[model samples]
Target chain A: MNWTIFHQQVFPIRHKLYRFALRITGSIHEAEDVVQEVLEKVWKTPADQSATIRNWEAWCMTLTRNRSLDKTRDRAQRRTAPIGQEAEYQTDGADPARQIEVQDLTGQVRRFMEDLPEKQRMVMHLRDIEELSYEEIAQVLDISLDQVKVNLHRARKAIRMQLQRVFAAEPVQTRNS
Target chain B: MKEQANIQALLDRYWEGETTLDEERQLKAFFSAGNIPEAYQAFAPYFQALQAEHAVQLPGNRQAVRMHRPLRWFRLAAAAVIAILLTAGVFWWTGGPAQQEQQALAPVMPPKIETPQPALTPSLEPAANPVAESQVPKKQTRKGTLRKTRSVAPEPAPEDTYEDPEAALAEIKAALALVSSKINRSKHTLEKGLQEVNHVDILHKKKKETDG
Candidate 1:
C-alpha cells in the first residue's frame, strides 16, 4: 500500500497505540518508541509483497507489549540486553507526559503496573485498558480464558493493594493522588 | 441463578475469578439497577471503568492497525519471497531453452526487391545451349551437317573446306588467269574507273559477264 494512506491511517491511531504501549511498557518514552517503530514499519512496507496489518492498534499493541516485556524481563535479569532492544522512537523529542499525564496517582498506577507480575500487567492492559474480550485477551497473550480471567483478577487485586497501601501511608488530604 | 439477597456471594467469587457465566450475567443485571448494593459498592468503580473501556473509541485505523502488528517483519519477508518467486517465473518464461528453440524455429522471410525489366527480358536472350537452338524452325540446317560430321567422321572445319593450301591456291590462280585472259583490253580501261559498290554489284558483274 502507498505510504500516504498508511501514514494517515496510522497517525490517527497514534494516541491509542501510545496509551496502550505506555500501559504495557510503564514508561512514556518506551510507549512512544514502540508506536513510532510500528508506524515506521507500516510506512516503509508494502502490503502486497508483505504482511498486511489487519488491526493496526492491535498490531502496534502486540509489538509494543513484546518489546516492553522484553525490556522489563531484560532489566529484571542481571544480564541486560542493551537498553535498545527493539527501541524505535526517541525520548528526547515530544513531551514526556505521553506516558501518564503528569498526575502523581497516574504515575503511581504506572509504577504499580510495572511492579505487578508481567502476566498480570499484560492481562490488566488487555482486559481493562483495551477492554478486550476474554477470548481476545487469551488469543493475544497465548493463554487460556481461565488464565486471562485469573491474571486480570490478580492484576486488579495488585492495583487495589497498592492503592490501599498508598492511602493508608499518606494523610487523607493527599491520599487521593 | 440466585436472587438478590444471595448475589454478593457470586460477586465475591467473580472478584476471586471463581464466578461462572451464569453468575456474571447476574452481576451485569444487578449493576444495571443504577443503584448500589452496599456489598457491591466498592466494586462499582471497577465495573464503571470497564463500561467506559468497553465503549471507548480507539480511533481504529483498520487500514494501518493490525491484529498482530509486530509480525509485519515476517510478513515482509514472505512478500520478498513472493517477489523473488515471480522474478524466477519471469526468468523461466524468457530464458528457457524451449524459448530459444522457438526462436530458432521461427520462419525466415527473404527480402523483397523490384526489377520489372528483368522479368520481361527472358525471351530476348538466346538459348544457353547452341545445339538446343536447332529445335526452332528458323535455325539453319547446318546444325544437322555439323552433328553428322561429329558422329560419322571426326574432322576439323579446315579439312573439309581447304586443308591442302597448295591445291586451293593452284585452283584459284588458274581461274583468275583464265578471267584475265578473257578480259577485253578496252573494257579493262573502263573497269579501272571506280563504280558504286552495293552488295548486289557482285551479282550484277557475274550476270553481265555471262551475257557478254
Candidate 2:
C-alpha cells in the first residue's frame, strides 16, 4: 500500500511481526532482520496487490514466519547457539532479588518455548503472546483449525508438565534444606 | 474462593486449548494481579512470560519509517533504469534513425555494376552517337555484391549546374519522389511477406486442429 496507509495500518504491526520472528529465529538480531526483510517485501509489493490482501497483519505474520524459518534453516547449517540465549526479559523497577527471580523464570519459560516443536511453538506464541484468534493463527500458519487447537493443546501440556516438575521439586529442595 | 474456582476451570479449558481469547485474558489478568495462593504459583510464570513477551516490541518503528523513504527512491531509480535500458535496447535492435534513413535511400541510388569490359581498341565510335554513349550499363551483377563504384566521369562545373536553380530544385524533387515510390514498393512487398506468413500460420493451425 501507499506509504500513508502502510504507516497507518501495516507499520503498526512491526512489533507483532518482530516478536513472531524472534520466537522462531531465537536471536534478536536475526529476528530484526527477518522483520525488516518482511516489511521490505510488503513495501515492495504494489499498493493494489497489497490492498487486495484481506488481512494485512496476518499476511505480514506469514511473511515473517516464512522468512524466519528460512533464517533458522541457514543458522542451523552454521550450528549457532540455541534460540533464546539472547532473550532479555525486562524486570523493570523490581528489587534485585525479585528481578533475578523474574529473569530466571523468564529464561525457563523461553527455554520451554524454544524446546517446543515448530508448529506447537508457533501456535502457542501466536495465541498466548501475540494474542491472535484461532482463525488468525490458522491463517498465519496456514494450518487447519483442528491442527491449531491440537498443537496449542500439546504445547500448553508440555509447558504445564515442565512447570509441574519444577513445582514438585520445590518441596524436596525445601525439605532437604 | 469463587474467583479461584473460576480461574481453575478456565485454566483447565485453556490447557485443553478450548478457552476463548477473553477467557484466556481473564486468566492472565487474575494471575498478573499478584498475591497468588501457593497452589497456583507454578502457573504464574507462564502467564508472566506471556506478558513479558508482549511487552517485547521492536525498539523503533522509526527505523522502518526511515527505511521506507529510501526504499521508495530505490524503486523509482530501478524503474527508470529499466525503462531507459529497454528503450535503448529497442533502438539498438531496430538500428537507429540514421540507419533507417540510409536503408530508405538505398534503392534510389542503385549501385553501379561493372561488367567484364570487352577486349576492344579504345574507340571514339560511340562518342558521336550520344544515345549509345549515354546508354546505362545492362549487365546485372551477382546478388551478393554490395560495393559502390565511384563515377569515372569528370565532375560537372558548379556554374553549369547552379545556372538554373529552379531546374536543379525540380530535378532533386523528382529524384526524391522516385526514392519515395521505391520505399513504398518495398513496404508493399514486406506486407505481402507478412500476409504469406499469416497464411502459413493459419494452415498450420488448421492442420493441428485436424490432427487433434
Candidate 3:
C-alpha cells in the first residue's frame, strides 16, 4: 500500500476503526493492536489490490472488524471467555444502586449496548455511534442491507426496552415525592 | 414547545431505527442542550451515550499509532548493539592473536634484546650507551634472522607496552568515548528516522497552507 494513501485515507479514520474494534474485542490494548494490524495489512496491500479498493475507509473498517473478531475468538478459545466480558464500557460502580445514586444512566445504556448480540451490536455501533450509512454498514459487515436494517432495529428496540425498564420506576418515585 | 414535540416524535422514530441520520442528530442536539422536559428525561441517557461515543477518540497521538510496529526501538537498539559488537570484534580481531602469540613467546625470547619498545613511549630517549650501540649491528642482524623465521609463521601482534597505568586508563577512556559517540550518533539517526516517519502530514500540508 502506498504510504500516501495510508496517511490520508486510513490514518484519519483510526479512531472510528479503533472504536469498532474496541466494541468487538472489549480490550483497549487488543483493539489498538487490531487497528495497528489492520493498518499494516492495508499498508502492505499490493498496488493492484489496493487500486481495486474503491472505498478505503470501508475496506479498513472491514479489516478492523475481521481482525477484532479473530482476536476475540482467539481469546475465547484460550480462556472460554464469557461473552459478558465485552462490557468494557460498564460504569466503574458495578452496583445498580450505586449507578442510580450517581445517575450514571449513560453508563447503564452503554452496558446495555455491550450486552447486545454481536450482529445487532455491530450494526447499531456502525449506525448510531459511528454514524455510517446503512449501505456502508452493510459493506463493512459483509451483510445484506436488509440484515443490517433488521439488526439495527432489533438493537435499538432492545436498548430502548432496557432503558425503559431502568427508568420506569423513576416517574413513580417522583410522583410519590 | 413545538420543538419539544418534534423531538418527542423523533425519539419515537429513533427507538424504532426509522429516524434518518439528520433526525437522529436533531434528537441528539436537543438532548445535549440540557434541561430536558420531565417526560423525555428517561431517554436522555441513550442520546448522551451516543454523543459520548462519538467523542471517544483513539488515545494518545500519532506516535501511538507508529508504536503498533511493535519493537521499532528494540530493532534500532539491537542494531546499535550489533554495531558495538562489530567494532569490538574488529578491535580484537586486528590486535588480539598477535598479542597472544607475543605473550606466549615472552618467556622464550630475550627480554632485553627482543622486547619491542611501546609506540607510546613516555619520553624520547636515544640509545647512547656504548655497549647497546655496539650491540646495534648484532641486534639488526638478529632482528633480520627473526623476521625471516617469523615470516614463515604468523605475524607477531603489536604490543601494549604502556608502563603508566594512568596512560592506559586514558587510552581506555578514549576508546570508550569513541564507542559511546558512535552509539549516540546511531540514536540520533534513529530519532531522525522516527521524525521522518511522522511526516504523515504530507497529504494535509497543502490543504493546511490553503486554509492558513
CA deviation > 4 Å runs, candidate 1:
A2-9, A49-53, A73-108, A160-177, B1-14, B18-212
- Write one digit per residue (lDDT tens) for candidate 2, span A58-143: 89999999999999999889988554454353323347665565566667788899899999999999999888999999999999
lDDT (tens digit, per residue) of candidate 3 on A1-177: 555567788889988888898888777778878888887788778767876888999999999999999999899889955444333443334566644532454456667988999999999999988989999999999999999989999998998888788887664222111
After superposition on all C-alphas, the RMSD of every candidate to the true structure, in Å, is 38.1, 16.6, 11.1
**Residue B182 of model 3, lDDT score:** 71
User: DockQ of candidate 2?
Assistant: 0.22
lDDT of model 2 at residue A41? Answer: 90
lDDT of 2 by residue, B1-212 (tens): 99888888999999888999999999888777877767787788778767777876775532444444634544565556556555665565446787666555543454322322221223524566666455523323332143222222122222234457898799779867966776566556556655665576566546533432
lDDT by residue (tens digit), candidate 3, B163-210: 799997997798779767776766665566555544533434444334
Per-prediction DockQ = 0.04, 0.22, 0.34
Summing lDDT over every window of 10 consecutive residues in candidate 1 chain A, give the lowest-scoring window. Answer: A84-93
Q: Could you give the candidate ranking by TM-score, starting with the highest? A: 2, 3, 1
Error of 1 at A172 (Å): 5.6
Worst lDDT run of 10 residues, candidate 2 chain B, spans B149-158
